[model samples]
Target: MATANTAPNPAQDTLALVGRILIAYLFIPAGIGKLMGFGGTVGYITSAGLPMPEVAAAIAIIVELGLGIALLLGFKTRWTAIVMAIFTVATALFFHKYWSAPEAMKMMQQINFNKNIAIAGGLLALAAFGPGRFSIDKR
Candidate 1:
């Protein structure tokens, strides 16, 4: 019987690299925008009625920017993905609450909510798989 080879494959590594880049790319810009507009971020969070809007904004910046950069570098891939997954899901529940949105905006909110959830699912998958050979985790 032939055994399945488990050695790392270049194609898989490239794909993983691409995945990391795509996901983290979304975060980096978002973080930068939030950081650049700190007051606006805090205001938005406050409007969501979350406690400690300032603190929440800071955490968002850290998670999106710091964790994002870590993911891009493939550093602590599993932990990073797990954290990002949690963050993404929480964002959907808190910020993308379609049920609470004005009727005119409900559809957009629903779409954003779904998108966040899907991104979280992807993050969870990344957590389970670990970063590929190309990551700083180095497989």
Candidate 2:
């Protein structure tokens, strides 16, 4: 009988590298867009009735861009993933609260809420598994 090969596969490392890039895609451009239209983002945050819209925007930029870059480069992978996961969930709760959204906007809010949940799932995986062999952490 042939046994299944359980040893680590190098291809998975390559896949992990690609996965990191894919995950980073979710944040890097968003951060840039938010920065590019700082006032607009602040306005949106303000509309959400969140306290300290400006401060929230600033923190969002740091988490989205700074941690995003770290994830892309696989630097401090586990920690970065943890932080990103938490940020994603918080974003969903604060901004994508579909139940509180107006009837006209409910569908969009639901989509964004679900999307953030999915992204958080991926981040959790990255945290548990680390960034694989291609990462700076070299796990």
Candidate 3:
């Protein structure tokens, strides 16, 4: 029988740390931006045909800011990553919806849709592999 290699790789740890930071960079400012314009965000969500736009906006902020911060700090990283992965998919479906976009906007929306999927893939990887040795979760 073959055994799995359970050893830690220093290079992999460094890469994971960098990946976590890069992913946080993608979301933290977005969350902060939403908070800075709460009403505007709620309006945008309302336009998406979502129910309870205000409450949905608040939950989005919490997931983006709270989970983004958690990922940055490497706190409860696996769970945070999983949450982020789901959030990314929901946002892609609700906000992007490239298939329904008008012709000119279709390309732009499709780009965003793909971007969210890519981000979700990264988040899933983080969920599966964890935050690595440099993280608070490791301490």
Residue-level lDDT of model 2, residues 1-139, one tens digit each, is: 1125564478777877899999999899999988999999999999989999999999999999999999999999999999999999999999898998899999999999999999999999889877878888985
lDDT of 1 by residue, 5-86 (tens): 6755777778888999999999999999999999999999999899999999999999999999999999999999999999
Q: Give the worst 10-residue stretch by lDDT in candidate 2.
A: 1-10
Off by over 4 Å in 1: 1-5
- Decide which is better by TM-score, 1 or 2: 1
Note the Cα lDDT for every prediction shown: 0.92, 0.90, 0.92
After TM-score superposition, the amount by which residue 113's alpha carbon in candidate 1 deviates from its true location, in angstroms, is: 0.5
Comparison by TM-score, 1 against 3, better one: 3
Query: TM-scores, in order shown?
Result: 0.94, 0.91, 0.95
Candidates, ranked, TM-score: 3, 1, 2
Clashes of 2: 0
In angstroms, how far off is 60's CA in candidate 1? 0.2
- For residue 25, model 3's alpha carbon misses the true position, in angstroms, by 0.2
- Poorest 10 consecutive residues by lDDT, candidate 3: 1-10
* Candidate 3 lDDT, 1-139, residue by residue in tens: 1125675688878888999999999889999999999999999999999999999989988988888999998999999999999999999999998899999999999999999999999999999888988899999
The top-ranked prediction according to lDDT is 3
Error of 1 at 43 (Å): 0.5
